[model samples]
Target: MVYIIIHLHGRYFIMKQGLFHCEIGMADKLAMVVFSGTVDRLMPVGIIASGAVAMGLDVEVFLTFWGLNSFRKESLTSNTKMSRDYEDMAPMMMQLMKTKNVPSWFDTLKKAKEIGNVRIHACAMTYDLMNMKKEDLADIVDDVMAVGEFVDIAKDAKFTLFI
Candidate 1:
């Protein structure tokens, strides 16, 4: 016997015995969250990654710009420097944190990766722009990739978000 299954949005309908049956919405099956912000900026991404993993979704995180620096294998403890173009300066915040002896965003990201299935990738173009090699990146990163590579990875994803 064959069961006819129809999916609308997050709802699933199964047709049987001339009757329609529905199943509750399941969590996302796959997700690709691209992170272009600083490591500290990745806190929310980390939470999302962990939450997705908890919900049994495959999660991939693409790290670019200052975000790449958060995953260095050996030195996962660097603070991100705000770009010169940033209108609202965060240096004062950083300074205050330093005064308070708070760990940098890098450390938090490392902890998150350690506790979750977060796959981190550094952008090759940004690597070249900054004259940084893959070896220069933090240890938590899973790979260094080109934009094409990342796009290819994200191609079959069921959900994609840029943050």
Candidate 2:
């Protein structure tokens, strides 16, 4: 039989299975590198992080370049433009989302954080290059981190995505 023990919040629980021993703890981690700033591209990043968090995965988002710009407090709420390749469809898509009562991508990410472990990091280099201060970023950002530091965190993630 397999035996398993899990400790949480100072409590311990045990389980038995067939011929194996296991220790259960934190779920897998998911890392995402968000580079695109367009609404359409940014939408998927939030949605995917929501899904991962819902499935018990910890999510870390590294925002750089245009992605970092999109997270600026002033831009987060007012921006609605999509990728240039689909610029013609932006209006239609925005209308459809409004008609369907879809939540904004930033709101979605915020909700995910409320329900699970979701960390958002802004690239230090991008922050400096753009002459932006940490206060310029949305409150959702957990910290400003160097690329090397982020890479170290992401290197062992169960899965990594570039969006």
Candidate 3:
């Protein structure tokens, strides 16, 4: 009789523990993408980021090289030489973008900011040499950071991409 009681008690305890140990996928995933290039290369990333945000994914973007310039307020706002590689045509493209109301880089940025859980990080080394203050960047950018810090964040990401 004592053995029977003890066995029933043990079974109850096991079932109670199983209720608490049942799995639930409440944790969201992480995505880290490295970008370094012209708007042509980086714009597609913005589009993708917006889509990911729509799907409820957390996104962190690391912007370097000419891609970094895309986050600058002036670069987003005015018709300026965009990429050094396209010295001759950059200005023209910028103006054409402005006239079309097709949403300049600035507009795309604003949409991403409004709809997404997106964090834009500037490269710290580039920021210092470029004399760019945090305030000089677009309103959408979350912070400036080094590659090491970014990597640390990316370590547990569900997906990491380079663009």
Candidate 4:
């Protein structure tokens, strides 16, 4: 089989005229396991994903449980929940962010997707447990994936972080 190497942005992706597209070569991956629903934890997911993509790495974010909840279309914009460790400070911090004109976590992640190869996968198990359909999730979510499938992708990541 013959393949052509295309450099889009910073990553090199292999493509063939009549075959499925897959990434190969110098393109590293940054995998993230986002398990937290709170804004405090979610913020880093977006920031880190953005940074990784800017540096020419593919980002695979697996959203499970609470993290998946935060991606629901209904709550994506309205969420104000904070981590338990800073529960009491949530109000003040939220207000501060608003005053400082800081973008919401969802917005940050959305921008990252626009700028680079960032794939956001919703957990299929979590979706079933939460009784959610594909439409229930925000548009930024690429598709539903099983943990095993996600593991297959994450196993070879240059580095993986749980947030």
List RMSD in Å for every model shown.
Answer: 7.2, 5.1, 9.7, 3.9
Candidate 1, which segments miss by more than 4 Å at Cα?
Answer: 1-35, 70-76, 80-112
What lDDT does model 3 reach? 0.66
lDDT of 1 at 126: 71
Pick the winner on TM-score between candidates 1 and 4: 4
Which residue window of length 10 is worst by lDDT in model 1? 26-35
Residue 139: error of model 4 in Å? 0.3
Q: Rate the local accuracy (lDDT) of all candidates.
A: 0.63, 0.88, 0.66, 0.91
Identify the superior model by lDDT, candidate 2 or candidate 4.
4
Give the winner by lDDT: 2 or 3. 2
lDDT per residue (tens digit) for residues 61-137 in model 4: 99999999999999987899998889999999999999999999999999999998999999999999989999989
Clashes of each: 7, 4, 0, 0
- Which candidate number has the best lDDT? 4
With candidate 1 superimposed using the best TM-score fit, by how many Å does residue 38's alpha carbon deviate from the native? Answer: 3.8
Once model 2 is optimally superposed onto the true structure by TM-score, how far is the C-alpha of residue 39 displaced, in angstroms?
Answer: 0.6
Kindly report which residue pairs in candidate 4 clash with one another.
none
Query: What is the TM-score of each predicted model, taking all chains together?
Result: 0.58, 0.84, 0.66, 0.87
Candidate 3 deviant stretches above 4 angstroms: 1-34, 79-100
Q: Sort the candidates on lDDT, descending order.
A: 4, 2, 3, 1
Pick by lDDT: 3 or 4, better one:
4
**Residue 20 CA displacement from its true place in model 4, Å:** 13
For candidate 2, the C-alpha RMSD (Å) to the true structure equals 5.1
